[model samples]
Target: MAHHRVADGKNSLRRRGVSRGLVFMLLAVLLVASGVVVWFQVGDHVGREGDAAAATCVEGPATVAIIADPDIAEGLSAIAKSYAETRPVIRDHCITIAVRPGDAKITLDGLTGNWDPQANGQYPAAWIPQSSVWAADLVTAKPSVVDGTPESLVTSPVVLATSPELGAQLTGKLDWAQLPTLARRDDSLTEFGLRGWGSLRMAMPTGAQSDASALAAQAVAMRITRTTGVLTAADASSKGVAAGIGALTEAAPRSPDGTPVGAATAIADAADAADAKAAPIHAVPITEQRLFQLTKADTTAKLAEVLPSGPTPLADYPFLKLTGDQVPEYAATAVADFFRFAEEPDHLAVLTALGFRGAAPMPPKTATVTFPVTPNPMASPETAAVVDINRLVFGPTS
Candidate 1:
């Protein structure tokens, strides 16, 4: 009886030891699983923290103000939006750009003299006028205003825009020299078999709003003087040039409401009108970029572009960073960063898409372009000369 009781006690002790071993093993497994979970959670948090630190803007959200020419403002605005989306960091500052349209003359006045921030919006960090002529004027008026050599972001030739039918009819028959006579003629379109069109009507750009009219006037002065080199101020004010420009101004079209039509697209839009005599604008001087955009908007756009046989002025959109004692270093850095992005092949595509001749711009498929790529030697295109010619063409600046 004693041996049996001893055997039972030994078996109970062994069972207890076995149970303890099983518990230790289970606890070990649980500890390892918890450790793995903690490690993964900590790693994820660190990774997220690293990313946040990189993206976090530490210094600033700097706004670079750009005073763009009205014509180029829309394109620049688009690029600026893209730039913001990328969260560009310039000089340790998160950067963005703002584009505002400022008339070349008015903006120059404000720039050279005093900038009424209330009237002119923000004090500009950069300025893009329709032509380098404005930059030259800036240099002449205030040599210290411009920081560096102004470079052209895009180039657009001023072309004659008309309906496809009328442009085709006038082909080989028209020249810039003959334009004044055509404007003054009694029956302008009859010779071309365009009978319904009475006298030649046009939307001559003369206001200081855009550089198109000024360029056209410069072309007129160039032809009248018969000079191919850079036009002098005296050459632009020749009597013959004034008379020639005067004739075209007299031919300005009147809308059905008897309001004077000065829009370059008036002639092109007239072609799509249901009425034959709706907007009887025979022709107008316009930038190729404007024409390209106008046609791109409408699938069934009906227009033709004609390049003059003679030299035509170019709208070289100049990018100028303003300089003065008050200009900030960070602003200049921001402008340069934006300009660098703009010069990239991808960004240049944006300008090309907008219709300016930038980064290998192609011809528009919508309009029939006679001379899409080439140009003759320009004349009298200097700012002062252009200003003189503008005076003759558009009259004195208001």
Candidate 2:
């Protein structure tokens, strides 16, 4: 009996010891797994933070951000690409530039009031708007942020264009003043073999609202107030002036309900349309550069140009430098370097090839079309403000 009791006590002691061993083994395995998990988690966090730090630690001259009008974006982009390859070094630091195309109004809006770099995408170290008119309007409305006078990179005059077939039927160079009277005459449409929609459809840009259209409006206002050389409040209020301007609006070629079509594309489409019944866009007010592009693109659709008389509004592509904190320390010098590079005769030649009138005298063929070398004529900011109001009351609803 004593031996049986002793054996039972020994078995119970061994069983308890084995159970404790298994518990310790399980705890050890769990502790090791937890340590590995903690190590990986810590490592991943550090890695991500390190990547973030590296991303923002770019050294050397800051990359220049150039925002430009879409009309000249392609040409500017090409110029930028060429500049990047050359890698012009400024102040012993290599400089780089990035170009983006945006709407002129949107870019102008972005440039206004305590310009925020991040909100404006990147600080516009340089801005090349379609015309100096926009820059002038901006400067007149708000104090300019431009470091100095905006450099005119290229120039183009506003011109009238029509398809070859339609142009052939029109009488001698049409005067800008005659446009309103002609718009009211239906007989002129019949003279061109155009009837109904195909008749003498005239297209003008949306005045005040669109830069191009506003320019056209300024041209009209110039004709209205040429003796004074500036549009005045009285001129805007004049019944005859208002009537003429209204006639321009009434004559614009649009959809059935008068929705404005894209000025260039509409003209091109009219020229290319297969159906003879499709009303051809008889005449459109556009820039000579644009006319050149359309004619160059389609051999079948030969667009002829009629230069506007008087002090015509020219598209002087201005290079504006952003001032204040919006611009980096190195940007101005780099911009100066770029300007120097661009002004070189060779670079000017390249710009001319892209359908711009460069700084240097162009070839004879390009010179045939006259544009003022030093045009001072532009609608005043106050005049533009009034025009905006008038357009709302007198222009198309669309």
| TM-scores of all candidate predictions against the true structure | 0.74, 0.67
Candidate 1 per-residue C-alpha lDDT over 1-398 given as tens digits, one digit per residue, 9 for 90 to 100: 45644556655665435577899999999999999999999999999986666567567677879988776898889889988998887656677799988877788898888888888887888999987656766776787988888787778888777777777787667767777877789876687787766666766754454466667767777777887788887787778877888888877664333212245456555644323467667777777777676666565647778777788778888889887755678788888788888888777777777677777556556635433655584643666776676566556544
**Residue by residue across 1-398, what tens digits does model 2's lDDT show?**
45644556655665435577899999999999999999999999999987565444435455877888766777666766778788566544567777788766667777675555566688777888877656765665565577787887787767666555556555355555666666777555554455443335666654322454446555666576553455666665667667776777677665332212254555556634323346445566666665565556453544555654555666778888767775767787777777777777766776676667776655333321333343444534353544443453335322
lDDT of 1 at 243: 84
Strongest candidate by lDDT: 1
The true-versus-predicted C-alpha distance at residue 110 of model 1, in Å, is 2.2
What TM-score would you give candidate 2 relative to the actual structure?
Answer: 0.67
Model 1 residue 248 lDDT? 80
